[model samples]
Target: MGPDTRARATSESPAGREQGQEYDASPYLPRRGGLAALRRASADCRGCPLFQDATQTVFGTGSPTARLFLVGEQPGDQEDRQGEPFVGPAGRLLRRALAEAGLGDEEVYVTNAVKHFKFTTAPRGKRRIHKAPSLREMSACRPWLAAELRLVSPRLVVVLGGTAGKALLGNSFRVGEERGILRPMPSLEEGEGEGGGLLLATVHPSAVLRADDREAAFRGLVADLSVAASALD
Candidate 1:
């Protein structure tokens, strides 16, 4: 599909989609092997239309055996350019928060619910801004995440935003109402497979960057993540 068609498709409201609709990612999954193989296979994935204009598939990066798996929304402009996740301003903030909460890079495995960067250009054509991934796009890419969760089998899955939370949990999940709490991973349908051991919801680091009080928001994020850190004890 062309850019305009893809944009229009993804711009549809969540309510516009029919109930119980599913997007399949199984065809994009690696036939055999682990994370390395999966990451390589993902680069060529055309599971959704988002890949058409995306710079490249931004796969998960971090320890293969880390006990904590962190899921974010999608790659920002910087990450899209750099071909990695969590390397932009929001990413810097996340790293800082992790440090404050006493968790190092080695302790976490980071990835996004959506592997592709979805964006729209400014009228002036100088800037590209993030566009939230539609539910269909998220669902189309979920199998990769489910595969990661299965491979890593972390003790805790830390959801960093509403997108990631809703993708893993459900549409009814609200980060504001449920942040910082640990919930069991609900069983999935016959084919969907389990995600994480225990799920913890929290605001995305980018939310702090956009907040009125950056300090307070940063601290709150750190506090929420600290709970995940403390869970290790």
Candidate 2:
């Protein structure tokens, strides 16, 4: 990572104030290793309070040479328990969507903006309801995602949902406004120049599952993903 990128990763955000001290995963990142080293190091991360409650840190998974990258908001109930990103119902939906969009499973790398699962317990059952990570939390955990970006260096990044979008593109990102448009990826200082690669934003698969018109929502997701597929051609 370049000095500027490193500086952003270590910088304090609001979550730091809430914790009464600065917090970020940057400190735990391996200064001299690849994805394997990063995954091992992340297991011990105490960068944010979310780790205190999460079962484990879910790191990105795929070959380093994958041409496509997919970033989601964070882990859901099933994903947290499984120690992998996108393994729940939403993940299943995503996999199907990718197939429909003509992107093979082996072509993509999958991960999340935040590695930990943030949630609140249900009052009646032992169920853990999903809670969206605050921007502060997203900022705190960004270095891991940044590192993944540096390593995978995919030709196109499909950002699923607003959280992942904001993590990559900043606060102004909106899925409704940005979905399906291919544009230059912002420089992460490790891969791709200013005009290299492309980023496309879309709603989270969970949102499609939650929609009243499930089929329509799923089709919309497929449509957006097809745009990404076309770009690779």
Best model per lDDT: 2
Residue range 1-233, candidate 2, lDDT tens digits: 35554334334433333536655778788998899999999987768778767888899998788889999999999999999989899999999999999886547899999999999999998999999998878988999998998888899999999999999988999899999999999975546567358999999999999999999999999999999989988
Error of 1 at 22 (Å): 6.3
Candidate 1: C-alpha RMSD after superposition: 4.9
Runs in model 2 with CA error above 4 Å?
1-19, 189-195
Error in Å for residue 69 of model 2: 0.3
lDDT of 2 at 98: 91
**What is the per-residue lDDT of model 1 for residues 1-233, given as tens digits with 9 covering 90 to 100?**
57775555444423224444455566768778999999998886766767767888999988889888899999999998899999999999999898898886447889999999999989996698899999888988888998888888888889999999988887888999999998876544455545447888999999998999989999999999889888876
Candidate 1, residue 225: how far the Cα is off, in Å: 0.8
Q: Which stretches of candidate 1 lie over 4 Å from their true place?
A: 1-23, 187-196
List of clashing residue pairs for candidate 1: none
lDDT, candidates in the order shown: 0.84, 0.86
